[model samples]
Target: MNRRLLVAGLIGIAFAAAAYALMAPAPESTSRPNVAVAVELSPAERGSLVTRRRFAGNLEPAAEFQVAPKVGGQILEVLVDIGDSVARGDIVTRLDDAEFQQSVAQARAELAVAEARLQEAVSAANLATRRLDRIERLEARGVASASELDDASGEAQAQQATVAVTRAQRDQAEAALNSAEVRLGYTRVRADWPGEDETRLVGERMVDAGDTVAANTPLLSIVDIDQLRAVIEVPQSLYGGLAVGDPAQILPPGRPDSEALKARISRISPRFDPESRRTRVELIVDNQDRRLAAGMFVQVGLESRRVEDALIVPRAALVNRQGRQGVFTVAPDADSARFVAVEVALESDDRAALRGVESLDGPVVVLGQDQLTDGAAITRAGQAQRS
Candidate 1:
């Protein structure tokens, strides 16, 4: 009876405990709130932004040509050396002219002999004409036979033919003399080309004094340095909008901080290179002060597009979310990022101009956007780091 009483009392106590546990109110605690993500932000701006494409190339002379001689001979003197400035019609090299001079003298002597023979023939022909007249008169008066008159006429005709032949020989001698003089003039090789440039630089000197060379042998390489060509290659995607007058900027080789030089597109190749598939572009850069030189590497910046008065932001701020291209913008008083769809107008390496992001009142997130969701809790990167 004592054990049953103890058991019944314990059961009653357990039932009372269960009843109290069920009746007690739940505690105020629940699930923890979402954690705030740390992100970098930048203020959206309203301005014009340009899409600039920079490429590496080299500075080449505007025009270059090999200077050569017209006749083969020994190089007597090389007047100009490499890096020498020369103008049109400047004599650059000389050849031995002793043989040429002797040839000219011989031609002149031959011409004189031919002239003397022509004069002798003319005198004889004149005498024959007078005799033929006398013979004809004698024949008419029956003082001479017709056969004798015919012989006199035949002799006069033969003398006239001799005069004609001698005159032809004189003309031939004059032509030979002219040819010899021209050849003699070739002994002095001159730098000549057609252009408006007043001067050119000697880029190379191939032959020196006492060097024998054949005709058309290269003596020097002349280059116009007053202007230079900035040659670059662009892929076909950007070649469509390019034109002849497009402006460009030339930066110094391996120097990104240096000032850029102004230039203009002078020529564009119509066809792309078959292997490279890139079109060639040539920009004319003024080197009036001779600041640039040929074969120097440089960077060329070409403006591919322009956006006027558009909303500008860092290119890093742009993101694609849920198949829509936009950026995450967080207001000053807000603790979360909001997705704002924007049309990208112009984009460069580090900046972008958007069409419809101006209405956003907060800065765009530049970093740590991949962890964000619509209305997700966020914290400034600076503030998060400080904490």
Candidate 2:
């Protein structure tokens, strides 16, 4: 019975040991150590900040003119061709003058006939006046009857009326001749630009020798390329800041690295395009050397706004955290440099204007900012690389 009691005591000890192992708690772990992030930093600078808007545009001539014939005829000769330079009043083309010359000759012959008739009428009027005077004197002397005197007066009046009618006919003939001469002059197509010695480029030639064309048919297109217009479509958001006389920089595609041509806004469309929500703006650029040409693509940069004495940082410093746009600035700490979040005001391609953070005397994290949080530890890139 003693042996059985000892075996029961051993079993009871094993059960108590198992219960204690199941109910015991686990030990606590030590806190994670802070990690030092390597980053590039730049000091905030106080300087001027200019905001610009860029747009793609095309260069066009400031003025364009269409050369057309004023009279219908077969083209006899095309004096100017495409790419030709012409001045005001220069003859561009000529039409067949055979028909027009014939018309002019006919008009001149009619004028000559009218002049001969007028001369004949004048002679008759002079003779009738002399005869009437003689008849009146005879009647006063009682040598001629009153009937003869009346007949002489009537004849003289009739001759005078005939002279007036001939004079009217002569005037009509002269007008007809002048009109014919004017029409003949229209057969010679001439460039009629506004200013003297203003050279224009012939953009297109629509007619050739022996081609028949009607009045007002386009024969050539001329454009003044000394002054070019850079036309750009500006969105509604940026249209408000644009105004006439505002300065602009024009970069022609051909000479991208060359100095930008200085230009000014000359015109802005009063109405907006509903489909595009944009407006057209015209910038005038001087090209006296003819370096720029119409239909060339160009880039236009316009200064929209300017800020003075603003705190600026590199664009890389900006970060979006919790739906907030900000930058990480270095803050002093006893053990390491800490990152502090500062809000961004305005941003450009390479730089950003910052605001809402006091004491910008500290450095800003340019690189390695993506992994940064408020109060996170950081190390300067140079120092980290050396270590």
Candidate 3:
């Protein structure tokens, strides 16, 4: 009887629990809270975007050429050496002049002999003319024969022809003397050039004393360092923006603290190199202070045209999504970020020039854009988040 009563009581308690769960009401439905993305923001700005470009090149002498002798001979003395400063008309080298001296003396002697011969011919012509005159007078007075007069006239004419021949010889000898003297002058090779610059430095020495050289062979390399040529090649795209007389600045490679050397465009090649697609441009740099040197690598900086009233932003604020370039803009009081496509008209190292977005009056997401989507919740990095 006791076991039956306990089992009945347990069944009654289970029914009561089932009845209570069946009569309870459903709990109210709730939604999840949205989290804001922390991001660094920068204001969109309007200003002029300047386009600057830099090219690498080397410095070279503006004027350079090899100094060669005008006549061939054995070198006797090299007066100027590499790195030696020389003035206009300065003797750079000397050839063996013994042969030249002998030649000049021989020409002088030949001229003297020709002069004596010409004088003798003139004297004989005068004597013959006087004899001819006496013969003609005697013939007229019937004291001389016709044959004698004819013979006297013929002799005078012959003597005059001899004087003419000797005069020709004398002129030939005088010309030969001038030629010889000019050759003798050639023995002393001079460093000469046509310019206002009176001095230049020898850049190379090709021969030593006692070395035989032919005519027109290079003896030295003379260079003018008063000014230097800065040679840089630019791509076809940048070539159009460059022109003669444009201002430029040159900086030494690996030396940022050095002062920039002022320069201006001097020459621009009309055609681009097919192999490199680059045009050669030359700039003239004054080296009056002699602070720069040839063959040194340098960086040349130049500026192109500027875009006015364009929107600009930091490079970090711009991002590429899919195939479009754009930025994410957020209002000052807004809690979401929105993407806007922009045309990057110009870009420098740290800033970018934008186009066609006049409505960009708000700050752009700079730092946490990679984790953001269009219309995603965002908050300023330093601003407090609302609960």
Candidate 4:
């Protein structure tokens, strides 16, 4: 009976071992279809690679000069109105010149009188000299007394002094005439800037005709709209890569396919806004057609800095894992893929410049990265060449 029982226990142990072998999980299927993914990549080229930094900014006229009155007077007429084009030295407004004209006439009359007086004094002096000469001749001949000769010389000297006084008065009248004429001229207001007749943009009129204005009081504002300046505020940290004369691209939103307007950095604010920690950069662009107006928002791009000619990929192609940015690149056979870590230099709309890895020579997986492992096999391939 003991032998039979021992044999039964042995049989049960063998059965348990058979059941464990059948229930064990099967090895992972190596035949399952590898993850299928689409990819995009960038080919290395010698073309310009710009480190485009975008900032929000407003478009403004390159220059605006206020048109103001040079003297206090009532405005007689305004030759130009808002949106009127003007050239250099073009009169914009006029003041009432009635008083100034009368002053000029009065000065001219005074000057004429002074000239007449000067001519009279000249004639009297000539006569006095001639008389004194005759008297000296007579004195030399002993026909004139010493006292008489002295009196003749004194009369000539007095006439000469009168001529000098008249000439001084004439000079003073001439100066007054010049001042009166200048004041009359001040009644006509002219454009402050010299620009082509077609390029002027005139703003609101501060004073209308018949209204009086003080000297230096703004009559109107004239802006040259032939060119526009885009003022962008850039973070101080990124200021190092930007400088005057650097090329930039301006993208006016909602126009994607339109050619980017070219611009250059014209001014860089040395000081940063304390509240925003950003520096203002001014970009000048020609708008000869006046197509760009002030206050229009523009996207400013500063170009060409670091990591040129790097292998680039669409930003969507990347995946982050454990603080490392990586993407799955397909093997040559198009049947397998391997994860690769890449160093990013710059990012644009939907693409980024990448570095690291000897050869990112083939297509990279843009989608389906989350399901991928280090050595995952891929069945689908990217027909589009890598950007």
- Which of the numbered candidates is closest to the native, going by highest TM-score? 4
State the C-alpha lDDT per candidate: 0.89, 0.85, 0.88, 0.80
Count of backbone collisions within predicted model 2: 0
lDDT (tens digit, per residue) of candidate 2 on 1-387:
999999999999999999999988766667878898888777777676677788999998888899999999999999988889998889999999888899899999999999999999999999999999999999999999999999999999999999999999999999999999999999999999776547899988888999999999999999988899999999888877888999998998766634778999999998999899889999999999888889999999888777666787788777888877766766544224454556666776587776754466466777888888877788777411111
Name the top lDDT candidate.
Answer: 1
The 10 consecutive residues of candidate 1 with the worst lDDT sum are 378-387
lDDT of 4 by residue, 1-387 (tens): 999999999999999999999999989977866445444433332322456767888998787889887789998899888888777778889899999999999999999999999999999999999999999999999999999999999999999999999999999999999999999998998886754444476856777888988899999888876889999998867888777998888888776724678999999999999999998899999888666777799898787465655676777778886788887777556566677888877776667777654557467776666777777655663345543
Minimal lDDT window, size 10, model 3: 378-387
Sort the candidates on TM-score, descending order: 4, 2, 1, 3
Give the Cα-based TM-score of candidate 4 against the true structure: 0.76
TM-score-wise, the better of 2 and 3 is 2
The RMSD of every model to the true structure, in order and in angstroms, is 7.2, 6.9, 8.0, 5.7
List the candidate numbers ranked by lDDT, top first.
1, 3, 2, 4
TM-score of each: 0.71, 0.72, 0.68, 0.76
Clash count for each candidate, listed in order shown? 0, 0, 0, 6
What does candidate 4 score in Cα RMSD to the true structure? 5.7
Query: What would the per-residue lDDT of candidate 1 be over residues 115-184, giving only the tens digit for each residue?
Result: 9999999999999999999999999999989998998899899999999999999999999999999999
- lDDT tens readout by residue for model 3, 1-387: 999999999999999999999998977769777788999888877887776688999999988878888889999999988788999889989999898899999999999999999999999999999999999999999999999999999999999999999999999999999999999999999988778889988988999999999999999988898899999999988887888999888988776624777899999999899999998999999998878888889999877767888888888888888988899998877889998889998887677888776758478888899888889999788632212
Between the candidate structures 1 and 4, which one is better when assessed by lDDT?
A: 1
